[model samples]
Target: MRKLLLLILLAAGFLSVRAQDVSLTKGWKLAIGDSAQWASPTYNDQHWQAVNVAQSWEQEGHPGYDGFGWYRIHVVIPSSLKQNAFLKDSLRINLGSVDDNDEVYLNGKLIGRFGGKTGDIKTGSFYGPRTYTIAANNPAILWDKENVLAVRIFDTGGDGGIYGTNFSIGMADVMDHVTVNTEADFNYGERNSLSKSIKLITTNHYDYKGKLAFKVTDPETKAVLYEKTNDAAFSVGRPFTYSFEIARLEKKSYTIVYTFTDEKSGKEITHTETTPYLLTPYPSAKPKINGADVFGARPDHPFLYLIPATGQKPLTYKAQGLPDGLKLDAATGIITGAVAQKGSYPVTLTVSNRLGSKTKSFTIIIGDKIGLTPALGWNSWNAWGLSVDDKKVRISAKAMVDRLSAHGWAYINIDDGWEAEQRQADGKIIANSKFPDMKALTDYVHGLGLRMGIYSSPGPRTCGGFLGSWQHEDQDAQTYGDWGIDYLKYDWCSYSEVTPANPDLPALKKPYQVMRSSLDKINRDIMYSLCQYGWGKVWEWGAEVGGNSWRTTGDIQDTWRSLSSIGFNQDKAAPFSQPGHFNDPDMLVVGKVGWGPSLHNTRLTYDEQYTHISLWSLLSSPLLIGCDMGHLDRFTLNLLTNDEVLAIDQDALGKGASQYLKKEDYQIWVKELKDGGKAIGLFNLSDKYQTISLDKNDPALKGYTKFRDVWQQKYVITTGKDFSAKVAPHGVMLIRVEK
Candidate 1:
């Protein structure tokens, strides 16, 4: 019976394994041409040039060169590497991320491939991290000896080469080593839930006779409030979970950490998660108006505005002292009409719920200026990347209307990947199959009282290698105008190809000038946005080129470094901010943003998210939501619906915030408001809770003594000349002060 069972199990093919990786960031020879001999181990590569694989070859000394390239390297494989108690029998190859296409080889044998030639079926293998298994013990590995690894790459256009951080050989799934889902294991948003869960999952064949330790620390004082340890054993992909009630813990955020020690491997892995509590309080159930108090429109153009209000359901809206030809839909709180006259009109907008009623003084300025305040809307880039489609866009539009329209969200902008592969015979650009009907889509959004936006580039191809305006600027602009595109994000992706070698400022301005002229010829107003990544001090010349907003930096990631570096460094461009013109530091990454169809919650901690929204508002930067609107969470919604916080960004004065005080990682930035008040952001850039204070003598808080916590919407009492608070790590104290 035992022998029969053994035979049954053997035939079933069962083996549990885990993998660790060896980073191959160095030692590579690159050449421009591809030959079959290059894949062989015996090929002499001494004459091949050494190159950095982190970026494209164009950025690595070879400029404007795009085509086939060969990368080769050699490394010795340790014989004992496979001997790891839990490691898989076969080695897994990771080529990192490659542009276009790639086929990797080991000892002259093709092991794995990506992109079109591989028949991947999946279109984004080149964009995501790739792992290919050697399928059990393969002779091509040549263990305990030097082995050659070669990569053949095919590039069509734009950026090309083998790039990304991870390039190595591992075993099985890298996550099999350890993956801690902190949010899933804990009651992060449930304040009344006393039970706390902690999970330890590993799929290794070896039973980790490991010790797992859990602890909670006071972030401010570094005091350990709870501590426990358990001798745990786990195998066969089952998660070892530990749960306990933390009713003893306080309401504020505390640092929770878990450490796992594998006795055999002697590996110590620590996972830390912060802010398992909610800070942004829920808005009042009673009626309250929010968002920009001021609105703008072009003379006699189709006018629409949603009275932004937050409260319980069944809210009523009314507008008084309105200009002629405008009507309000009390049922939907949407005002739609076209005013022939161009002037400033003050209207009192009121919203009432069962609990109470709130009124706000609103202004409508119909003149040449548009985008009077930094745009508050959504863009498709972060959530869906190049995979965005018409269906996804429609879903986003409906979501914005249902959940976010009441809080002043507008503009359903499609970024990249919407253009047809080929333009029309008449030189007019058209939407791709993904967006079957661009005109109808615009009408759908406009009918919902929301504006529609489109994207293009000054080059022949966009960043996603789609059709751009290029030399046919007039035709493309005319096409967009005919479709009633309200905004245009003109990227400078492949436009560099047309620029002169070591081009001067004039050459840089030429493409934008061409597009601006083309837009001017159109019959309607389309907000021109410059997406040049803030190179060469664009703020000084952006308005002159007819740009409503210009990018001040490269793309923003969800990491703290990306957020701070891009947001805090906008002071140089602050002086140039004004009505109808603003500095853009990229879109908001506060929600789930994966740059593709697969979305993940932002890596920013809860505190970091507050800092992100606060600093962006202070900078007067365009607030473009780059998340999947269909996946709106309560916490993310609250973070966005804070009327007091958003009012700073929409201030009519349009003066950007300046860094008034900087102390290492602690900073205080202040922006002037249109109402003789100042919006102040006291940011703690450090990793620890810090006592951030403002002195009356410092002048940033001089006569601005009647202070109110804008985020909390409560006035505070302070004595003497100092105002202080123990701000959380990567958090901020947003306040509005007046004399």
Candidate 2:
């Protein structure tokens, strides 16, 4: 009886040591200003705003506010917990995280300090875990009654106050004594055969003496692809790495399970992790090539003609064309590089994956440079939508010539809504009633020394349900050239409906190829702009299909979310931009823009407009004005007339800006200029004003440099080692740095 009682007591004691954590997410009272009296336990805080401990005070209606704030909360010590001998002696407090810096107080006594103020303001780790112990020797802490907890926070900029989800206040040994975590080497890939390294860990130094088992199961079928077991023991401070090898896996998500079973107690525990293997083209129908029976290519300039082919990926490509210096990429079916010879070269292109193989014949006609430096133009979609007319277009052309032509704004693009509802009997699309005569309108615009552009779609109807060049690519191209249209905006609208279940390379490339072939047959040199809304990563193969520029996103709205989303997404598309071909983030939504019959000023703020223009310029996107040229405000005119600012967009190097420095809401974009200079845009996307500084010591900047403010159009200040600027919300500071 004595032995049994001892065993029972030992088990009870073991369970009693488990971690008991108290969540401090609720009952927080926040005050905007700092005060020493607020830290007192008897101080009244009934007028303070209620705020969650897991979110910033800035998110709770305190926009753009920075500086000191105080938060207080009441935590009642339960009778059962206060009497506990272990917790009565020592208590551990987990404050989660505090922005910039913070100081904690328990019952009016200073308890802990994480960051800030040791004479000068010192930077604190924003992500560092806040775990402090209240030594059992402290006499201020009340154990038998309600306890007061207070925190003083300081925010330098952006979001301020305690935030994040891992907040908790608890006693020592109140958390799980043992915790398991797993880590893997490779979680994503397209390899047919590969090996993975995995590591397993357990906290609290608990020795795991058990039967270890490993299994890989398909997520869809739950079929076990691999399984293994071993008698193993894991202990803290010991290496625990396991290697798993797979021969091949179909393209899909898979679950990996690792289970441990104790041999003595029969207790079982399991841990799971997920990973995926992506195979190209995926399994589809048989492979086949789709394009014109004959194609054309030019010499001396870059030419891209994607060999459109449908079916499975891992597709092998081979071409019989004898054009010197030009070759086809087997993986993407894109034939690129400058053609050395101008003569007609009949080529047979073949594509084959594991499924099947097919071939097609085409021709190449290489010509002069298409897009020299990203096209500087004006698009009508933003200003007028489908309410455009011949008169509105002519007025816009006049405005461009009078107000912006000298600033290098040339192309005057007429977006959708110009086409009639239906095509003629001969399959030729005609202008709508608003556009009386297309040829006459083009001629009038051309006489003003401005190029005229037209819009169309590969589908039967456009976004506005207007006539499109579906089966009339050849006829439409001839007609457009006859009308002297200098550019074409080809949008993707209803095309997806009539295509195959899953669009492959051939399906996407066929329509564009048809237009390219048609344009090649014409005498005029038309700049092609693909408006496919970035589907299929058009930047990779857009130039191959004769596109001078391609839309990298859907559309841009006059809002911060729209501007930030479209601008930041261009980070990945920079690699594909070059001298002739560029990435387009829709049209610039600056100045006045609204659907016709009710036109009004743009909804974007003054600062946001500057950011929009700066980001688009740095992104190497086409600077197409999406606003009413008929009514220009002085501010709008000033925004558009800065040649120095626009010069960055027209840089001859054709390099897009890269985000070299990103910290919270502040981003520094740098673009290499043709003259060995660099154009930098210091942007603040947060609601609060932020001070941005960069020094010569920064790895991104090398050697001594001079600076010019592109927007202010003057050199404000020069610094040898560092430079700083206080920027407003959604504002951009455009600077040109020269060595």
Candidate 3:
């Protein structure tokens, strides 16, 4: 009797294990090219490509394919489970996620379809999870036999397949089909946005009503901080969010417990999660590294790169793969040492606190060449938006050569509105109606002793909605080289539309790498400028991708709010600026900005203009004039022609400025000059006049310093270690200090 009981228990265990969910991972046969006959159940797929279910077709032998394909697999249902309670009630199938869209068929019989010709799928519907119910009495399903499941998938680009975490066949049990998800495992600071949700799913559209109770409490103290109860009803598969206005709680872990009781069956379910939050206000002190993905250093120069990480306190850092002679501070994340090597070193940085830790990978290039100084040029966007024409461009080039080139200015860049509505038959981008001949126009600009710059996107369209160099990167680079183009402003624009969801740094850097390779294949030297609006901290690795300058901020408008926001934010990115790659703060918005057809003086006041020039020059930002040169007034000309001021920007030292001292609305910005001198700008950002002063003994200004007013062209004798002046509202006092 004991032996018989043990056998029965073992049998029951085997049945329970078999009743669990089955994920369709293996045994998938993929047809590379699309065909209507491939969807048939009788089609012979013996010689087809074997592909994994939870992976992109792009990785499985279809590198750049963006079209229709078919995947077939046979899953067997054991005959012994024909009378199983789970299958007898109902069975549900989850196909997971596809790239763009797909149609599912069971043994050549159409069961359901989504995100394609069926008209139910929207643009990004392929990313949505799919779940369908196979009722107990459904005749389409083959129970206790071999079932052939075929899926027809349409991929627009990138990865396409049945992918992600949950692609399985399981029993339909609505009683326990609730899953909870939170935005992050941990939370920090009061400014952080947090979200928590509970997904309620049911089979056969079963209506479920239940009571949900949520409570958040300190694990150690058992003190309730947040508590709420609500009624939850589900007629379909939808996620309901719980409102959590996180308070400024103490820096300690808190447990969130969830309880659910079914209204009909009285079956209770509970789940608990823990999250820790810091109540620090805006501008967190947490450790954070700023700038591009890569940093450049000379072979023999003393390299000092500080990882800009901030947090409350007691934060420790560790670095792996540091080259010889370089050392990192475990407490500060400051890397200092003279680099004598000339190779790329992949360095991993980790910052840990009492709460948790964060890690990031960075590259230190010992020797790479490109940006000698901040680029000085004129872009047509601010003056003429999408109305750029060849005649206007030729005139601008002439002005650069005749008036601006003598003052260390070059690069007459023709911004957006240049490409045609579509690419040529051979996949080459051509000039639009506004610009008749691109090659000839480039030659004209080149012949006038000024280099020419062109604009294009990594995607299909520019910001002006014209054809861009997406898939035709190499062809467009060759065309630009043939036309004598000297620079390329590659914008992000439509590329964001096609980018994968939550694209990693490698994914974001791939397009730039493709364009870099394209440019290297050409003979002409084209300066690459990345315009991804500072996404992914281009400053850290802009040089790695051959970017001479990377946009560190978004597009700059001609308003003070826009200018100040972009200008003042450059302090954190100062250390990343070097000879080959500088942090770009978008185009200048000085002088007269027509933005095409209608011209008006810049909205900035005279004082604001001075502040703008002083800040940009000090920050070592690319000074791209975004105005019509033909309409330059004397004041605007004087503002642009200050060689003394521009000298600080053109300083060979390549050290960007930093706001060393900020007292109230008065800020003191300092930049190291190449000649052992320092350029300082005392700025008043508030309204109304204010008296600003700086201690002459400040490190920015060595003791016993003599100052020269660059804008005024005068010298001021210094006594002791003090300097004070009444600065105009929204104005700057730019001076050079000689130690």
Candidate 4:
């Protein structure tokens, strides 16, 4: 009995001991002033103000404060806390994401530092998560006593301090052997399985021999669909990749569980993917017209507008009451010619086939403004990145003409990497060898009734280290104008290389102003786009700098987290948007995206994709598709070609979505339309299906009792004062509310 009791006690002790993390999210003392002596553990912090370290110091009553700040943490480390960790020798602290830069100190010694300004650029890893691991057996650690941690931070502008969620310290464990990408994949091309890439970690010293199992179950039925087990081994510097797939999935979700067991340590790591793949139903074959109701261009400039329509093949097109200079091709739906008149000429556009006929009233607003509404088109960055070439661009243009142009998709904007390695001695930038004939490419796009756009930087080099405008802003502008470029994405990349570090607002606006001046001198109406990642609140001064659109955030990635954060956080910049100017939240992350030569299916689920399109339309953001046009599937095409959704974005009022109601489980954003109606996006932010109910008399509903389901294209009758919907998780129900 004693032997059994001893064994039970040992097992209990072993079970109690684990790679447990100690949270340091709360109870941290902070001060604005910085000093090196504050790093010392013995320093008196009795008078230091107590603060929580979960978010920016701005929210902690330090609003409008910028520059340097310091934070101190005090905690006790028990010797028994490291018991069950196989690699208990090392300690790790996660401070999450800090704006700009930071330096971590423990016991008066610098343990780690991340991101800093170099040269004139105020460079920092503001968005990168911060995780630092202390060396094994480091003397700076107080094993069974008190410890003091000091963090020094610097913010160039805007929000600052220790921000983001992960804040904990834990002993190193042997099971940190793999990282499974949480941004699950969906069907696009021939491949039709929900997949996740599990990469074996090669940073630790221990080798891991384990059994890995993949089990998939019907989320609603709780019945197992597929199961598999495999013996796996991993070691330092060993490359490993594992993927999971389940065939024959329906519209419903599937629960994917991955189980990994270590043979020697007896540790098991399990990951459950509650819902993975989703497929948006394909559109019907009936005729439908898509695109902006209003089109604008400078008088005498080549006017090109494709009657964007979707339906059966061999569709016929016609325009009634077109101006004398305008002409349309009946079979191709292409309108070409220039309007010398400087006035609004209303035209009735019609498209028909054997299946059905559709007609819409479109206005040819020939005047000074071009992008009166946001530009809907495709860019090459997320599709080809620096590998964009003439052949690839031509292929994209052909594909856009074949499938997308009929849906109002336009510009074939070539992103970075088109610049030549050098400029001519006479000072003219040229395209690289990949694009031997730039003007011809532009002409080809224009011939197809599509516009062309190009990218450049205000610094000595672009983001891709290619030639930039620099002192030759006018020269480059003239070159783009001569090349028939209709839009300019002026990236503020290496411009920091020319200016001083932590430049003032004037210096920040200088480069864009210079380019704007150059563009004004040119005869073409080139739409100016400011892409400084929202530094200095660009939305407020964007139009002042002659900008037609300005990026309001950083680059967008194909994941639920990236999409939700960027889309939902647009209220701050929405008010600044209006006609001929818009707030760009980067490009769309749908379709096949890889940011390189190779591409794969996007990591966003079907529901999240619906939310993405609906939100962007309501925000009135410039819709720039960031996927390879040659690889577009039916679902992505549906997401882009929704005429009603596109109308919200192309409204003549040019207003963006404003958060009307927000709660823990859901949110409703409302956008005003030109027709006195309102577009509302009912979004579910929870992890499970939620029923969203709203009163018809709500101010956002504008006393409207009748509504049309925009996506479903059906009217929904509400008998009572309230209307409701059973929204899927990460899903959206977009509707047009009217009397």
- For model 3, residues 205-252, the per-residue Cα lDDT tens digits are 556678878898754456898888898866555655555556665533
Tell me the alpha-carbon RMSD of every candidate: 7.4, 28.7, 21.9, 8.4
Put the candidates in TM-score order, highest first.
1, 4, 2, 3
Give the range where candidate 1 is weakest over 10 consecutive residues by summed lDDT: 1-10
RMSD of 4: 8.4
lDDT of each: 0.78, 0.69, 0.69, 0.78
TM-score of model 4 vs. true structure: 0.78
Scored against the true structure, residue 354 in model 4 reaches a CA lDDT of: 91
Q: Residues 491-541, candidate 4, lDDT per residue (tens digit)?
A: 876676688766788987899999999988877878888988787788999
The weakest ten consecutive residues by lDDT in model 2 span: 1-10
Query: Of the pair 1 and 2, which is ahead by TM-score?
Result: 1
Against the true structure, candidate 1 reaches a TM-score of 0.81
Query: If candidate 3 were superposed on the true structure by all CA atoms, what would the RMSD be?
Result: 21.9
Q: What lDDT is reached at residue 319 by model 3? A: 88
Q: Could you give candidate 1's per-residue lDDT for residues 597-653 as a string of tens digits? A: 666678787788888999999999999898988887766887887777888998889
The parts of candidate 3 lying over 4 Å away from their true place are 1-368
